[model samples]
Target: MKAAGILTLIGCLVTGAESKIYTRCKLAKIFSRAGLDNYWGFSLGNWICMAYYESGYNTTAQRVLDDGSIDYGIFQINSFTWCRHGKLQENNHCHVACSALITDDLTDAIICARKIVKETQGMNYWQGWKKHCEGRDLSDWKKGCEVS
Candidate 1:
């Protein structure tokens, strides 16, 4: 049993680099405190729904886009534009490294996401928002999550 536990720990260290997948309510509470609720006319539900569809609340999620740009973190922020990945020239409008977006600390991610919304003037920057959340009743996203 001790050997098994050690192997599991080794496996996690080898395969997962600081990954944290948050439950909806827990993330909702965190986001609420981040002032995501009703931010720029987007309700907390919209933010919750976006987090779900973007990365399933995974803090270290990553996806490579068709154009070879990468999306990182719960927001799946693009590397080509919003952040610097240290590989190529990036717009880096948010002045954050893409690596910063994938850590357990969400401060960088949330700040960058807000900048994206502010620059785009809405949630249209995220396809997830356009498809799964737009014009939809997203009230249940934060329903049972008592966020004060």
Candidate 2:
């Protein structure tokens, strides 16, 4: 029984590690429905471009930073200021577990992202956006994705 339980837990962990990488159009629709299409004066294309640069649209993507803080999920929300991982001190403005960001469901990520935008310098909070999506014609990001 113990071995069975251990195997089950391992299976679950392995499954969790696998991320869902959304297609650009698919993500555009999702973000549009979530009101992120033009939120904070940025287009849905900007969000899509940012997600690609941040996590390649992989929900389970996580990167441990040089400062020991982890960026989680497709948007790569950070542990240092946005989320709490384990017992680490965090600002936790998102009011969610860092683990929550890495799930297939992006509801929490979208909600937290909204909070970050409202509190900080809008989409500029994501360096990915500034580097790739800003000051560029991002129409190709959602070119054929009719997000109605």
Candidate 3:
């Protein structure tokens, strides 16, 4: 019985490790379109973390909150506002797509984040994003983040 339990644990670990890296190149290209290459490394990390917290990285994730409203996709974008910005699936342009816009559009999410940080904290406010991405190679995001 103990051996069976141990094997089950190993199986779970293996499966978890096998999880695919969902690094979407098109999304990164979109960021490049917005001229956010310099910040894409840290920005992508923050976007990943935020999406994980919001929807466990499920691009199709949806849920009904206690407020009797439905939240859609990876970033849990509430339906009404989501419709205002991006398409709903078919193009895979659900909440995840909208999130990509944070880096792609540049003005909306990036500007908003900076404002919030500057208002509550100060300039150089994105230091936290930089800190979180420390030691993680930025080369992976270079397609979108590298200026030169």
Candidate 4:
């Protein structure tokens, strides 16, 4: 293998180390501090539940959709219309690179998520919420987290 290939391999390893799988309770605290609680009539449970269904709490999660776009981070933010993958940033409503969504630091991810939800006018933008979280008693998501 060439030096570039080796460097790429090392980069992957480092990136993997940079990721994290946060506990539910911890996530509740984080989300609360980040102002996700009832931000748009959606409780903290909604946020926590969506994060679980989207990426199982993993920070480095990435999913490639059928349309050649990808979903990134714990929120599974879509690259097609939300974030940019390469140099093309025209359609990136989140104003962030797709890679920013995968980082353990969720500042950008949270901000972008707000934009996505606001633009769509609701939490219906996330299939996870519609499938597993919506119309359900999501109180357990923040149970004992003391985020309230």
lDDT of each: 0.91, 0.89, 0.42, 0.88
Q: What does candidate 3's lDDT look like per residue over 1-148, in tens digits?
A: 9999998778546333332223445435444565544443335544444444555544444465575444544445444433233443332223233334322233444444333333443323334234544445545444454333
Candidate 1 Cα deviation (angstroms), residue 39: 0.4
Candidate 4 overall Cα lDDT vs. reference?
0.88
Q: How close is candidate 3 to the true structure, as a TM-score?
A: 0.34
My TM-score estimates for the predictions, one after another, are 0.88, 0.87, 0.34, 0.87
Candidate 3's displacement at residue 118, Å, is: 14
Question: Which of the two candidates, 1 or 4, achieves a greater lDDT against the reference?
Answer: 1
Q: Which segments of candidate 4 are over 4 A away from where they belong?
A: 1-17, 88-90
lDDT: worst 10-residue window of model 1: 8-17
Candidate 2, 98-134: lDDT as tens digits: 9899998999999999888889999898999999888
For candidate 4, lDDT tens digit of each residue in 1-148?
6999998788668555476899999999999999999988899999999999999999888787788888989999988898888875448988898889898899999999888888896889889889999999999999998878
Alpha-carbon RMSD to native, per candidate? 4.5, 5.2, 10.8, 4.1
Residue 58, candidate 3: how far off, in angstroms?
A: 0.9
Q: Which residue pairs in candidate 1 collide?
A: none
Clashing pairs in 2: none
Q: Can you give the lDDT of residue 44 in candidate 3?
A: 52
